[model samples]
Target: MQINTIYTRSVIQTMAGKAIRDLRSGGERELRNVAELCKGCSASPGYQTFWSLLENILRRPDQQYAALLSRAANDVDINCLKTLIANLGLHAYPNGSQPLPGTRESGTSPSYWMEPLDDIMDPRMLHQQISRLQKQGTSSFLFRAGQKPELETILNIAGKHRQCVFFLICGAESCCRAYLEEMTALGNVIPLMEYETLAPTAASLKQAGILFGLHRRYCEIESLQAEENLLRQCIALGCFLGVYEGSAQCPSQNWELACYSRLQEMRCNGAQEIFLADLWRDREAVQKLLEQRSGQV
Candidate 1:
């Protein structure tokens, strides 16, 4: 099985490299043409809204940043990109939207925590579980737990389902050169690593054509400026998204609102995506806060 997996990844890496090269050669004309095709597909508001957001992002005044996003888009697998834009788009833009092709409404989030697979558990069993989840509309899986070897197994399984994205949350040590190569080869797995750890390898990751995000835990005492600075640093580091997980110790209502306020500020900036890990926990309160804030604007 391992041998077959290695062979499969080798083939995928070659194909993916060709795809990136093809996309790079095509440049913005191809991307814009694809966007136009999407716009022509459905006159539905959802399609219009999604394409608008994508177009706006692509048209940002910061050409360097915009080009970086454009190149990142080209680098990511189409299925993975659809899964990301579909799942993250809904949260990032809470109003009327439609799930992109090959995406579905996952119940607890397309992203979730899965325990490391034990020796007794057939790796196929996890694949079956993932298949079931995909059937039920879960487009992404967050393997927030597990080590290098364990993650490799999960990535192998997750790679089988191209329509879904599996995120491997790791630290700097875990996200070393070889591991990143393995992930880049896999084509469907993304690294969501510690925010602080991103600096050392951020440039290399971008150069390697890997799309990665940051996982940050915020506390009650963290000032808004501090959070803003961290977010700016994250964007500058070529982070695709910022996963803001609130510290359990700071679960007070006021603290949560404050955190969301800071998050919303960054979200409005339109530089990088921001996801609130515990948003559902305070769904009602946060929804109201977002609504009120949006109205005030």
Candidate 2:
């Protein structure tokens, strides 16, 4: 007989035992033993192994099954995978079982992107712009122009509101330096600087304390050299940043923003605004947050 067929028959027998016990009394121990056996059974291949096993033992309704599914989903590192396991049973689950895409499964849902800033070009412009944008019910903004003074001003404004700034750091080193200066001047807006570069590794990124993400086709040696230089500066300045590898086909801007949100949530308590002084001086705060969410088992 096929292994799957034999397993299926064993599952059926276990379910039958559970059902029969439910109709009578004093069979709790027997049901428990059967549940342990099922859990010990190796999970099947593919994404739906746990789901199948859970359905096969539905009569027992083990809490361990739910816990296992959650852990397994996180292990896969695919957001959709978590949703699939959570919504559908472990095997041959039907579609439309999970929550809609773009919604976070764990932490609080992030705020939507606020109005885009056209006039503001630098972090200095953040103060006034953030106030004005807040009045309009916006939380985040992207400034494309590389104006240092303007960026600084904006960062200051956003600092008061605890808002975060996502600065696109493309172009020359001088331009990137100017952007960083403005961020320092604002002393507030949680700075999430995304540079267009090739090298995307944890060690390479740690130097900047700045979040890093790769640009499409940035794997060339020249691009990698520039990125390394930028990362060194980021580390020296004690910036809070991460590395993301981009793609020509997907671009990854939206996905990168999602990662930024996760990081911001780790640092801040969903506050709409943040301050640089608090961010830097709050060593205890940073330690606690990092320790709690080290993402390690």
Candidate 3:
């Protein structure tokens, strides 16, 4: 169903009003009403808009609404605002004409500053920083090595960027790798994949139209065999490759098995490795495959 912006805004405004009213007085009844309102509101058109508006209202120091705002902000489903509030604190929301101490009227909050890790290398402090960043929608940050001050400076910069993607670039060493692996598992960091040079295969040559004529390029036997094999593997893993388009497309028995048989015979005869990237270029198809793997579809 398609919903216009005006209608969606109206719904959000109505929901926000009801939520605020509930927060002001009614107990269990109000909670139920707010939940109902939330359910009715469409999250499609403007999830962030609704959240920001609600957060701004809740940031007021009024004791009556503070508890409700806190509770709502902490809710797992709508916790995005919690990150903003955590970083901005009380200064995020101002009182009428007067602005909060740490915040400027321009609405730009100051960056968080951190001490040098060399001077105060507390694991607990690193954990806390990582936790705060995760909540703030940051995904990744770069970590340098050798120069202690440079690493410390980068951490401080990263704490404020709120980037949702991070890449750690340090010297390749056992200690660095160990530390990075630990941090990645803890959701504090993401390690970059090691570089590897790939050698071109028969499949790659065929793909470049070198092995087959232009008209028969897509009909390359080895390339087709490799794709079919990968598709079969995906299916065996409970993945659906969606509908296939061809004159010989079968609908009765599982096509995965049929494809696998073709691939196995070709591989036995020395077929080349198929580039994973070449087999899956459609984003929608890739997304569906991921969802299927994760049991989302």
Candidate 4:
């Protein structure tokens, strides 16, 4: 399917986490505020990615240090970046990045950005990026759990026009914990929610998208039972079914036919919408699969 799938590999998540830690640990070298760095490199994709890594680190500061929270700013590398904290009299973390001074102890350290695909951008820029990207076609917003105020801020920035964006929030329960009332109040913001209570009226849900639930569990079910379960979930969710690939069974159209008995079986089983999410990685492959799905032979 050409529709984008949510991807959260452990390696990528680990790399991002380590990058944030490395950045934080080196704060003793030099420090520039975030705004100064961003103003110069707003259009630079590399810089945007780097700054994004930092904002992500401070996604949720300590409750005691919460009053001194700096979302759009960071302890920057001043040697390489510009400065604007000169006269504004901002509270600089002169002590550099470290744990909050006083807290209840067994004394565990703080962790940041737990979600596998946690991409917490500054709301202002994220709104613009989303608006721009979705204009080309349908796109997704990966909202991390335990970050509702941030999500709400981004939602307000996105404003009234939210038709094209699909929100794939990890840890739906945790998100509900923080913004349960606010979540129900909104027309958009579809977390990976399964409950009838939280599932927005089907109208509020986007028109056509697939769900990839308990992906690894596919191997556990018997082949016949797997097909049946897939069909059932698609019906219950009112969406397409998406699966990961273990082999080239999809694109080759040999073992798994593109124009043969399996397709007929799928059709007979009332499986109208199914896709291999692994193919979504390649633009050309995704377009070809999309064409196949559309019967554009």
Find the candidate with the highest TM-score and give its number: 1
In candidate 4, which residue pairs clash?
none
Off by over 4 Å in 2: 1-112, 121-128, 167-169, 172-205, 214-297
TM-score of each: 0.61, 0.28, 0.21, 0.33
| Local accuracy by lDDT, each model | 0.54, 0.36, 0.32, 0.33
Candidate 4 on 90-149: residue-level lDDT in tens? 111121112122212548432210112246557666666655544433233445445556
List, residue by residue over 100-192, the lDDT tens digit for candidate 3. Answer: 122235596522221112333354565577556444322333343345444444444444444232333333231243343333232222222
- Per-residue lDDT for 284 in model 2? 33
Predicted candidate 2 versus true structure: per-residue lDDT over 1-297, tens digit per residue: 235533543454454344334323424454445345444442323223433443444344432332222222222223222222221121221121111122245664422233446565445454566665444323345444355555445545544553233434343331354444443343232233444322333233322222332222223224434534554454333333333333446544564445434434422331211111122223333233222222221
For model 4, the run of ten residues with the poorest summed lDDT: 87-96
Candidate 1 clashing pairs, residues 3+ apart or interchain = none
Report clashes for each candidate as comma-separated counts.
Answer: 0, 41, 4, 0
Better-scoring candidate (lDDT), 1 or 4: 1
Report the C-alpha lDDT of model 1 over 42-141, residue by residue, as the tens digit: 3345446656766765565543334554656665555444444433323223232222222124443222212223442357777887766554434556
lDDT leader: 1
TM-score of 4: 0.33
TM-score of 1: 0.61
